[model samples]
Target: MSEKTGTFLVTHADEGSAVFRDVSDGQVHTMASNPDVAEQDVLEATIRPQPPMEVAWEVVEVAERREIELVDTDLSPTTQAMEIAAEQEVGDVERVERAGEGEVHVLSVPPETTEDAAADVLDDEGTIERAARLGAVRVEVRREEDDGVLNVRYLPD
Candidate 1:
């Protein structure tokens, strides 16, 4: 598969509609105009300006397990994270290391047979119950890895 993956940019303003000249060869797309949207909805963004403005983006991408990198991932490896989360029998996430600018929350997941526990943890809605639910039979509940080390579960099926 191509190293390039599709991205879903969700922002008040369609900031990704345009890109810098150097990076514009790819990774650029047209924006859909929305008139119903209030000025505040799209503050001073790449698209439009608001009365008082501030803009930001939330980009998302989906990739297969083989396409994922262990340490450099934007999100946790749900498969592994969940397995680790479930095994510890605890629910508390702590930042293990800084991933890019965002930190990595080494959540513990049950040792069930879910494909990607780590990814689930990273995509979590910041709710333990929700994260846990994603874990097939096992939940991606964050637990401690002894001392102050926060990790995922390690329970066996």
Candidate 2:
């Protein structure tokens, strides 16, 4: 068979190989992949049929890759909002105060924001960038019941 180009959704990936499903044909193909490839990643690749089965395929080159990251909602509503805001644009975040070593608390979020809505704005690229710069990998959202004060704490992984 000849070479084909299509987008593949990675169903499984490990140090040795990866399994991807063609977005166009719903066909699953396993190929030798870089260990960095991960599940749930969408990859655009050049493929060729393998052996006797036309359904079997191998990747020639990866043209593109995309991944959707899910954010945890264990934090308080306001902190979640600020976390998303920070991810969207760290420059837009203000009143970031240091809580401890590798820890920071953000105090600028309004009291009325909902957690689910805030979680929607989170993306891996921004989160990773912010985490690397701040030297932390965990975020905690806290709210004071009496005064209605909201604080976002960034902590180590």
List the candidates' TM-scores in order. 0.27, 0.40
Error of model 2, residue 85, in angstroms? 27
Cα deviation in Å at residue 16, candidate 1? Answer: 15
Against the hidden true structure, what lDDT does model 2 obtain?
Answer: 0.55
Error of 1 at 98 (Å): 2.6
Best by lDDT: 2
lDDT of 1 by residue, 46-136 (tens): 3322223223221222231111112212334545444544555434554443232223355433345222554555344232222222221
Q: Which candidate is the best by TM-score?
A: 2
Q: How does model 2 score by TM-score?
A: 0.40
The Cα local distance difference test for each model comes to 0.30, 0.55
84 Cα displacement, candidate 1 (Å): 11
